[model samples]
Target: MKDLIKAINGHLAAEFQASHTYLAMSIWLRKKDLAGFSSYMLAKSNEERGHASRMIAYLVDSDETVELPT
Candidate 1:
């Protein structure tokens, strides 16, 4: 269970990183006047954030500690 928790935390961190990346891409797209692509990337960023939130909730429900990435 400890290892599993650790793995989930790692995945959560990855999700957050992915979210950040997508958000950055969205900003770049918007600056380039690509509204459609920017919106898509923004949606993807929200999805990744949602995934991370779900993971955090799962850990909380399981009575496990969630360690945020540095």
Candidate 2:
């Protein structure tokens, strides 16, 4: 169970980082006036955040102490 929690946290951390990258790309695209691409990337970033939230919630509900990745 501890191992599972650790793995989940690790995955979430990676996902969160990915969200950051996506957001950056979105901002850049918006600056370039590519609204469509920017919106798509922004949506993808939101999805990643949602996934991280789900991972955290699952770990907490499973009675695991989830240490959010640094």
Candidate 3:
């Protein structure tokens, strides 16, 4: 259970980073006047959020403790 929790948290951390990356890309694309590219990056960010949420739900179902460290 502990390992599973750790894995989930790791994935969550990665997703968090990816979100930041995509967000930055979107802003950059906007400044470049590429609305389509910006939208694409935003979509990718949403997908990462979904992936992390699934892992989190699985960990919770397994009765593992999930913590977000600041």
Q: Write the per-residue lDDT of candidate 3 for residues 15-68, one digit (tens) a residue.
A: 878877898998899899999999999898888878878877877787887665
* Residues forming the 10-long window of minimal summed lDDT in candidate 2: 61-70
* TM-score order of candidates, top first: 1, 2, 3
What does the lDDT read for residue 69 in candidate 2?
69
Which candidate should be chosen as best, given lDDT against the real structure? 1
How many residue pairs clash in each candidate at the backbone level? Answer: 0, 0, 0
Off by over 4 Å in 1: none
How do the residues 1-70 of candidate 1 rate in per-residue lDDT, one tens digit apiece?
Answer: 8899999999988999999999999999999999999999999999999999999999999999999987
Off by over 4 Å in 3: none
**What lDDT score is found at residue 33 in candidate 2?**
100
lDDT of 2 by residue, 1-70 (tens): 6787788888988989989999999999999999999999999999999999999889888888777767
The clash tally of candidate 2 reads 0
Decide which is better by lDDT, 1 or 2: 1
How do the predictions measure up, each by TM-score? Answer: 0.96, 0.92, 0.85
Look at candidate 2 and give me any clashing residue pairs.
none
